[model samples]
Structures are given as structure tokens and as C-alpha cells.
Target chain A: MNQIDIGKWSQRDLNMLRTSSDTREIDLLTTSVRDLNATLQAFGSNTRSDEASFRVLTPNGAHAIAVGIDAPLNVEIAGHVGYYCGGMNKCASIIIDGNAGQGVGENMMSGVIHVKGDASQCAGATAHGGLLLIEGNASARCGISMKGIDIVVKGGIGHLSGFMGQTGRLVAFGDAGEALGDSIYEARIYVRGKVESLGADCIEKELRDEHRAELFALLKQADEAHKADVSEFRRYGSARKLYNFHIDNAGAY
Target chain B: MCGIAGLFIKRTRLQPRLGELLASMTSTLCSRGPDSAGFALYTAGEPGRAKLTLTSVEERADFEALGEMLSRAVSAPVSVVGRYTHAVVTVPADLVNLCRNWLLENAQDVRILSEGGHLEIYKEVGYPDDIARSFGIASLGGTHGIAHTRMATESAVTATGAHPFSTGPDQCLVHNGSLSNHASVRRELGRDGIVPQTENDTEVAAGYLTRELKRGRSLGEALKSSVEDLDGFFTFVVGTKNGFGVLRDPIACKPAVMAETDDYVAFASEYRSLTPLPGIKSAKLFEPKPATPYFWEH
Candidate 1:
């Protein structure tokens, strides 16, 4: 573990680091959240920055660690983080070395957030656009109400994942808990393992060549291209029965 | 936004450090819950004695006199020790309910926290850090323990509303997330004569478990029944005299993580709370699945 004295680095220093093409390290235990957030805000405000990298140590379950960052820098958090670790992220490539609490990449417009360990509930909740990848299992509501994001989970996901999704793709390599993809719309789901139960309006469909290609590409991006066969996945999507007004389905509704 | 933590020592060597480890784990979740904090410690008890924990609205109360009165009424010795706004009363094991009934009829200002041969509960409405320090929990020793920090979603912030709710002898429960069907369940349990002291949904859950256990169901079986009957989002960690358990609701929206090593089995609302545990770096870590109940006995 690299020990860093947070007092040695200032927010101004962080801005300069963003402009410079070098890697930096910051210890969360040694610094206050105000300073760390100030540094992240400064890094976000400046556009057209160099390819800088930051290594954060001892996150220790703090919430909103790298929220609302618009930069394309590489950020790595060394320990477990609390809620909203990469919330509202844009263009940044954030990585968590350990497990993440709730809403790891919630509402991200554009970016890549990778968790090397397990993620809590609502990992990518309500995200519009981004690529969220989890190497380990994710708890409930993994991609609820997703608009345009593409999520890839290598392990099992808990209940209520991909609920009310408007548009996007969710690919899971392991089992799904109860009520997966409830009341979904447009978004497609691909699961390689057992699905405990399907949600309302969600039905399994045949895997076509186009879906296989897409899954393969997603796996390559998530760095798991050679791990499994893409043809093993089953597809799930909305049945479109709930989209129109029908008096026959009134009692069901 | 509540925090729940539990520690069960599997190795005999780590038994003495249970309180120190649990205090650190519970204190890590201070930011998650700032309204109240409480813990239930399972210490060594005398063969024929039970401990009754009580909390008053204020720090000043006639706990000594209450103990004397209880001793006289039960025809047994009763000893009292005051800690902050709470007190522990030790009496004969079989007369626990007698003393508890006496308190309920006489001492209206004091609330019974727990009554068991091996369990002692302490709780207060304050910052979690302050409550832990005031109780001097770190220096205490035990075989196992559980704690909670409450954000108070359903009820007001009171010591009675704090978690580690003990509904049965040597049994306690702490919870995260709200129960959507708690109002109906509370009514149902009340009809069964398992009334709860506070309006907190967690207390209702505890009452349900106590009722199930009273009906000759095992801890694991009661938890499994909870998965079928309980509605809403919740991650519950229950502690008994000789066992520990964890259960998540079907939806499982709430967060829960468990870590186990040769030395101990630990649980927390988040993984950060498990960092201070011994050998956690190499411990077997996993998130409990939804609707799956897990139990550990010693």
C-alpha cells in the first residue's frame, strides 16, 4: 500500500495534475471529502485535458467518491466505497478495486465504470448512457430504469434488475434472482445462467446472430471475450402486450 | 439509511475481542445512521441468573430502588448497575418475566430493553460514535454481539426506537430498510399477544421471530418463513444465545455483506464495516442472496 499525505496535494495541484500527463495518488483517510471532491470537480470542469490517472487509497465506504466528473481521466479507488461512487459520471474511466455500495454508476451520461468486486443494489440505476461492468456479483436493481447504458455483469445479479428499463442492453454471465426485467421497454437482456423468475411483460426469446455478435463485442470490451461462449445466452425483452390499450387485458392490469 | 453489524467468534481465542471488533465495525457506519445507536452483547452469565436491561427517558431514575422493590416482590436478590440512560438488573433466571411484568405495571417511565440469561442490550438516541464511547463498548468482552445505527424512517428518534430489538430470551434482531406490510403484520402479531413496545417496523420483525420461535420453530426455519410472509425491502441480522443469522427479503434492494474466516463470522450493511475485523483481508466474502436465510451456531 502506498501511503500519501493528503495535505501535500492541493486542489490547484489536482487541476495541474489533470493538465499534466502523469499518474497521481491520493489517500482518502488522510484527506477530507471536501478536498477530494474539490479536486474531482476541478478535474471535471476543465475540458480537453491530458490523459491523467489518479489512484485513490482507503475509500472506506465513503459516499459520492467521484461524482459528476466530466473528464476522460483514469481514476482508481483502492478500497470499498459507499453509495454513488461514480454517479453522474461523464467521459471518465473509473475503476473500483473493491466492492461498491449502492448506485455505483447511477445516472451516468457517458463513461466507463468498472468494479473489480461485488456491487450493492442499484449499481447502474437510471443511467442514460455509459458502459458499466461488474466483475463480481451485483445485488438488486442492478440496472433499473436504464435509458441507453450497456451493462455487463460477470456474476449473479439480485432481484429486480433491469426493471422499467427504457432502452439499453444488460448482459449477465451468471444467474439472475427473482423478478428480472420487470415492466421493461425496448432494452434487451442476455443471461448465460439460470433465471429464477421473469418480471411482468418480460419473456425469453431466441438468440439470433445479431445478438451473439453484440454479446461478443460487449464481452470483449469488458475483457471477458475468451471466458465463455456467447451462443449460450438467452434473450429477454418486453412482450409489448402492455404497450397498447386493451379491454381484454384490463383485469390483468 | 440504517447500518447493521454482527460478529460471532468461531475461535475461542477471539472471544475476548468481540466487543472491540464489534465497536469498530458499528462505529464505521456512523455516517449512515446518526440518529441512534445500540448493541446487544452475549457475555458469560451465571448459572441461575438473568439480566434485564432497562432504559429511562432521562439519566436520573430510581433504578436502585426499583431493583430493591423487584427483589422483595420476587423473593430473590436483584442487583442494578447504571450506565448512562440504561441500567442492567440481575435476578433469578426463572423470575425474569415476573420482574419484567412488575416493571411494566409499576415503572411506567422506564422501558425494558431486554431480559435474558445471556443477553444485555444498551441503546441511546445520539450520534453513534458518542453512544459507543459513552458505553465504553470497546473495552468490553464477549463471545458474540450485534449492533445497529438507526436513521429512523418509520418512527421517531428515541432510545426505544433504536435497534438490536430483543423480543425473546437471549434473542435480538437488527434491520435495514422498511417493511411495507409491517402495519398489517403488527396488527396480526398483536392479536397473538406478541405486542411490540415501539412503532418501529424492525420491532415488529423481531416480534414475529419471537412468536415463531415460541411455536417450536428453529431460527433457520423462522427466517425461511419470514421470506414467505414478510413483505417489503429488508436485510435482517438476528442474534440468539448460541447462534447468528442473516436474511434478506425477496426483492433484496437493501445492501448486505458477510465475511467469514476461521476465527469469526461477520456481517455488515456494507463491506466497509467489515474492514476492521481480524483476517478480513483473506476472509471468504460474499453477498447473501435474496430470500436465502443463513445461520451459524456455536
Candidate 2:
């Protein structure tokens, strides 16, 4: 058996391996990002039943690290990443050990992206499906236009979070900045701490048993089931007042 | 979009590497603003001496004879250190105004970039890396620095329109967003005898801070009030003789990421610019909150 040192393997060498169950390590310092994404993208077309795991080292705040992955492969990024780290992700679990720049998991179809450190503005904007778990705080305008995605933030979220969401679930364990869920629709928000102010067309709603069950499941998925209680959280959703062209509510428009 | 980067050294041992670290940081932001680049560096100053940074297109014809003429006018030894298209003239602290007035009346070709005891500003219409290399920024030593790369939104891409705009002694400001009410604010400032050097909006903001500081307001107070007075989207990084400050507008659409360690506090438009710094992996990184003023002084 020939044991290949994964660290010494070049981009050409990595390209030769069609499918493998072994974990591959790709150092971004030595390998180009184009090659890394190309390899990950190739897994989407593979017919193999085995799963592949990849470990990316020294991300160094590079943009578009592992975008457009369509397989159930697990990818772990070691350091900080720039804009759109795991954008348009599908069926893959991407973990970022360090901070992430703007739009960490934008427009993902399915799967999970876990950011261990803080995330910049718009953490999970316009995503149709999947989960984005942020251990640290997320800055302004998180989940601006979501179709269907589950987001669990362990820390605080900045202003205008969950704005104009058509359908989704956003859970924040810490305090929320001003104007939470402005002009929102259908998407539910559960915040445990203080909400600075609710946005236009968004209002606090009673948390029922089903909502509690949903929140509990999300908290468990984020590994904070024991740290936070479902009953302690308050639910917010659209008031549905501005849904139509009402003459009385012209000021809101 | 524009890019802003700043570094304030907390540990005395790291002060000597300020320029080298800032140069690397600024180089990473070349894509954000490639039209022009500028930087302001603060060094230790003598008690009775002041420095004026000047730039001219005709460096040889304008700078060579101006130093001797200014020295004779001020009756003090004024030494000029000339680099590519820029020079720093040191004069007696009390005679700085006289020297400035003489230069304004006598030297029509030379333009003053900054005037202060410890501050020296260098800026040009070029790529950030090229500008940093031309000024030898990597070899210079300083206590703190602020740099800007401009994309030229509101004004022409001239050297004077480039950022790190200095309106007062030892004070400079770099902005990453556009101001909506600069024309009104410029007119308002004109009533108070505060005139901006360029049509650029960032310079108008710098002039506003200079007026505020001249009125006995601290840097923090000035920044806090700026959020209310300036109507625009902005992430401003301000540098003074002894401090550094960062502030964002209430509607902070522009991006700003800040990192702090035991040795220094750094701010950039994006996280990529900070990757070149030492011990950055262990640094406490966070985005500056909106409508808040954060300041650190020596």
C-alpha cells in the first residue's frame, strides 16, 4: 500500500483522485482556491456511495472558499474567511472555525454551515433552505430576504435582522439590535433577550407548544438546548397589516 | 467603494513597526479602492518644532528654493526632506503659521498636505501599493497611522481628492462611504470660517471635525455629534496627535471590521486586510456597532 502525504499533494495530484472515503487536507496557502472548489464541485457529479470529508487549512479570509457544493460531504475550514464562504451550498455540512465576512451562507439550497466565530453583515441572506448556526454575534441585516432557511445565532444580532422574510426561522439567544423583522412575512423570530424595537409590520406573538417544540429542536441543533430555555424566548412575526394596498396605512409604505 | 485602514500601537515595542504593518494592511485593500491612495503617520515631536508636509507636481523647481526662502522669512532653520513629489518641512512651532502664510503667498506651486507637530501625510493618485512603495512607507517609523484608498465617487480622481484629509494640526480623517448632505454642510461650515480644500465630501467631514475640535470638544464628543450632524452612510476612521477613533452612521450600509490585541488596535473595511498582521489569529475581532463612537488615546 502506498501512503500519500496529503500535505505534499499538489492540485494535479488531488485532481487524480476521483472518489475516496478518506479525509483530505488542502492548505489554502499552497493550493489555489479554484482547484479546491473544482474538486468539491466534482463530488456533486460523482456516483460513488461513499462520503468524503475535507479539511481546509489557513483560509486567511479568502472569499468564496467552499461555494456551490452539491454533495453531502463535510468540509471544515480552519481560519477566517471573506465574503460568501459557503454560498449556494447544497446537502453539505460546512464548518468555519474562525470568523466569516459578509453573507456567510447566502442562497443555500440545503445543508448546514456552522461558524464558530463572529460573522459580518447578512449572515444568511436570501437562502431557500438549510441551517446556518453562528456561535458568535452576527452583524447588521442578517437574513434580509429568506425563502426558507433555519438560522440559529448563539450571540446577538445587529439591526434590521430578518427583514422582509417570506418564510423561515431565525433564533437569536442574545439581545437584538433596533428594528427586528421589518416588513417581514411569515418567517418566525425567537429572541431570548431584549429586542431594541420591532420593525414595521412586525409584532410580538404568543409562543405556543408547536413553536416551543420548533425552538427546542433548533436550540438542540445549535448545541444550546441546555443553555437556553424555549419558554424564555419571545416569538415575532408579521402583523399582516401591509399585505395589501390599504389607503389608511400609506405612511408605512 | 472606498477602503479605510488604521493602526494604533498600544505596546511601545511595536511602535517601530507601525509603517511596515500598515503598508501590508493597506496593500490588501487595493481592490476596494484602486483610483488613489493616501496615509497619515504620527511620530514623536519635539517641544518647539512643527512639520508641514507639502506636495508639488514640479518637485525640483518648487521645493529646492522654497526651503531657503522660508528659512529666511521665518528667521529659523527650516529643513526640508524631499521624496518623490512630496516634502516635509520642519520649522519652529510658533512660526508655523508665518511659514504657512509665506508659502501661500510666495510659493504658488506648492500645496500643503498637512501641518502639525508630529503628523506627516502623503497621498497620490495611484495604486495603494505603488503609492506606499514610492513614499517608502514600509521603512518609516511612527506611533500610529491611518490610510485610505479611494474609488472616486463624489469628486474627480485628483491627488487632492484622495483621502486621509487633514484640516487641522495633527488630525486626519478617512471615510469609506458617501455623504448625502455635504453641499449643505459645506455651506454651513463656510459660515463658520471652516473651508474645505477640495470638493470631496470626505474633506468636508474632516473640516467639520477640525471645527469641532477647535471648539474644545474632545475627539469622542466630536465623533458622537458627527453621527447626528452628518447625513450620509459612513464608516469614519479618525486619527489625532495622541489617539485614534472609529465611528459609523446610524444606517451603516458600509462594512467595517475591527480587531484588537495587546499590542495594537486595527480597523479595516474588510477582514482580509487584517490577515497580514502578527498575532491576528488570537486578536479579539468584532464589527463596530452603528451610531457609536469608539476611541483610544495614548
On lDDT, the candidate that comes out on top is 2
Model 2 spans > 4 angstroms off: A1-21, A45-50, B57-62
Please give, for residues B1-298, the per-residue lDDT of candidate 1 as tens digits.
8999999999889888888899999988898899999999998888999999898765556789888988898899999988777889999988888888888888888888898888989898999989988988887778789999999999899888999899999999999998889999999999999999888899999999999999999999999999878888899999999999999887676778889999999999878899898788788888888788999999
Residue pairs with clashing backbones, model 1: none
What would the per-residue lDDT of candidate 1 be over residues A17-97, giving only the tens digit for each residue? 243457688898798766876687687446554656788888877888988887776788987888899899887778898
Give candidate 1 regions above 4 Å deviation. Answer: A1-21, A44-50, A250-253, B57-60, B180-184
Candidate 1: chain B TM-score against the reference chain B = 0.97
- Provide the lDDT at A8 for model 2: 35
lDDT value for model 2: 0.88
TM-score for candidate 2, residues paired by index = 0.95
Q: lDDT per residue, candidate 2, A44-107, as tens digits? A: 6352424688999988888899999888777889989999999998877788999999999999
Candidate 2, position B267, lDDT = 97
